[model samples]
Target: MSSLQDIPVHVAAEWGNALPVLHEIRHALERLAETGEARVIDLNAMPFGPGDEDRLLGLLGQGEIEARLDALGVTQIRETAVPGVWLVDHRNADGERLVLHVEIAEVPAILRTQAEDLRDAVAALDARLATGASPFPHRPDN
Candidate 1:
């Protein structure tokens, strides 16, 4: 098995809304969990930006992200920051890690029906960005 140093930064996203894009984040974590051993650092929930830190704690408790990760058996670490990005580290059976970086925003009703598709769409965006390709506007394939 590879040590933590073997972990590769395969996925990452900037700060954004914890609720609007959380489903995609869960899907990413699910993909990582499927590999059996993976860790995700959720920086979106962290306090950041002007007046965003104004709240000591709002109605959106921290439980949402943590609970989802626990259900997936994926390790999750949280930090404070802007509200739109999420970073994930994925692992393979060989114990090699690949990072999955994501930029999550509100998914339109057209694409929000299924959970897996949302994940795939976001992952696709990450792939495009990594390859230095421009993202064509997402049209609902459904």
Candidate 2:
């Protein structure tokens, strides 16, 4: 099997954007650390040649968190091995990819809890508390 470093990290010369994107990610990471600023880079906007995307994703590798959300369709969020770097994929109901983004932040914006969701959660918790119900179902000990 080819090692990660053996994988060339650049796109075809004419589509020379992948390596620069890595540099951009690095800078964005620095900015996020120094100031609480975050960044989102749209991968679909770039002209990536064959194998370039794979190479980039390979370099980033996989981190500890992976999340899948279904609101309209499906959105997959994953953290890269590097801290504060996340990969987000948004797909339509038909499962076609609509956008791919590299988001440099503690958590990708798509994965963050929305205000509406917060309100619903709060209301549900308040109701549960008023009813004096346990969130967990009762289980008999063996």
Clashing pairs in 2: none
Q: Across residues 1-142, which tens digit of lDDT does each residue of candidate 1 receive?
A: 4687598745354334444345545564565556633334334455444333223224223422221132223423222242323333334444353333242322212223468877798888777677754445763333
> What would the TM-scores of all predictions be?
0.22, 0.76
Candidate 2 lDDT over 44-81, as tens digits, reads 99888877787799889999999999977999999999
Error of 1 at 62 (Å): 12
- List residue ranges in candidate 1 displaced over 4 A: 1-80, 106-142
How many clashes in each structure?
A: 20, 0
What's the CA RMSD for each of the models?
Answer: 18.8, 6.5
Best by lDDT: 2
Model-by-model lDDT, in order? 0.40, 0.87
- Report RMSD for candidate 1: 18.8
